[model samples]
Target: MKKILMVATNVDQIGDQQTGLWLSEFVEPATEWTHAGFEVTGASIKGGKIPIDPNSYSNELPRVWDGVMEPIHDTAKLTDINPDDYDAIFFCGGHGAMLDFPNNNEISALLDHFKQNEKLIGAICHGPAAFVGNKDVNDSSIVKGIKITGYSNEEEQGTGLAEAVPFLLEDELKEAGASYESGGPEAEHVVVDQNFITGQNPQSTHRIAEIFKEHLS
Candidate 1:
């Protein structure tokens, strides 16, 4: 069976606000992948108890708390992961990702391994933060001159945590030399550039999954 490594943030705090992995960001795609018969493993910078963004829950969500609990609660530490064992690495987003994803040695090395091997890599919303400081096998910035997208600055500002995040995602991605693309806020936008896939916001999760499914096939 094919294996996929799904990553989420362990960070639960953003200044005085509580923030972690956004539920729909992880849930929507994860469900799609699993239903398609992929063996998915969850991991984090820290090994256990993946935090959930309190704001992502509602009366309408399918209540997948039990289905995803095992992986989320027993996450593998990013440093302990072996990129070669999986077909892809998918980063799920939230404000927490901004705290630990960028310029992180473990994540950088993991991403580098995937890029060097030409394996599929994907992220949605703030999840693209994991690509920061990563380079391809040729030693050029992985995002340099590549097409990508993520949660925009305006969207972040709309959440009222703009100042809480370490950096503005849109600006940071452009500065990293990515030809960033977007459909603005609240729009579903997914950009697939070779093996690198990124989505613009929560609304884009299903589309990201579709792209990943096509890549896997």
Candidate 2:
């Protein structure tokens, strides 16, 4: 069986408002992976309970909230996990990801390890924030020249958090040299380039998991 490390932000608030893991982004993919018999481990920057962005809660939660919340509620610290243990690593998104995913040396190092080993890597929505400053062995941004997609500036503006987020995800990825693409606002779009797979938003969650499984196979 393949193993996957799913990383979520511990940031429970963005300024005075609440923000954390986008519940559907994490839960939907996790449920799919679990049902497929993948061993999925959740980790956070600080470990412990990973907060969910209240705005992401939906009626669908009650149907899939059981087994999915365990790993999330008590995630391992990112520093404690060995990147070598998993076949792939997925960064879960939320507004909180913009606050903590970038500039995180631990995440950068783990991404480096996975890239060096030719292992799979994935992220969705604001989760691509983790790739902002991450670089390859050549010291070039890991996303440089790759086709990737994430939460769009339009979508951020729609949320009225264009200024609240640390940086616009689509813009940051482009700045890193990625050829950013999107399926417009809230449309499902998943980009698969080599070992890196990125989804555009929460709407792309299920498809991201499907593509990841395809690549794993």
Candidate 3:
């Protein structure tokens, strides 16, 4: 069976309040992957119980909660894993991802490895924050000139967190030379650029996962 390393942010603190994984961003895509016969494993930057966003609670499916919670509580430390073991790496997003995914050495290494090996790599919403630190073999940002989409600046402002996040995801992606695209506010937009796939926001999760599985096949 193909294995997928589904990563969630360990940072639960967003500004003065607490935020963590966006339930749907992680669960929706994960369900798609699991149903498609992939072994999906969750991990975090800190490797422990994953924090969750309270606002994301309403969409939870009780049947899969335990399965989702299992890996969150027993996450593998990034340093302890071999990238060679997985077919893909997916970064699921919440506001928390904006806090930790960028500038994380381990996350960067995982992304670089998967990209180098021609393995699938994907992210949704602010999850694309993980791509900020990844580079190509030429030592340039891997996203340079790549068509991609992520949680947009407009969306951030709409959420009233325009100033709260460390940086604007869309702007940072553009600065990194990514051909940033947006699906115009909460719309489902999934962009596939070779082995890397990115989704615009939570609404695009399942579609992105489905695309990833299609690519694998």
User: Which candidate tops lDDT?
Assistant: 2
Query: How does candidate 1 score on lDDT?
Result: 0.87
Question: How well does each candidate superpose onto the true structure, as a TM-score?
Answer: 0.94, 0.96, 0.94
Question: What is the lDDT of every predicted structure here?
Answer: 0.87, 0.90, 0.85
Better of 1 and 2 by lDDT: 2
Indicate the residue-level lDDT of 3 in model 2.
Answer: 96
Tens-digit lDDT track of model 2 for 1-217? 9999999999988877899999888888888888888999999989999998889986566766588878998999988998878999999999999988987789888988898898999999999999998776678788888899999999999998887777888889999999999999999999999789999999999899999988887
Candidate 3 similarity to native, TM-score: 0.94
Please write out the lDDT profile of model 1 over residues 133-180, one tens digit for every residue.
666556667788889999998898899988878899899888889999
Instruction: Provide the lDDT at 187 for model 3.
Output: 99
Query: What is the C-alpha lDDT profile of model 3 across 144-173, one tens digit per residue?
Result: 888999999989999987888989999999
The segments of candidate 3 whose C-alpha lies over 4 angstroms from its true place after superposition are 59-66
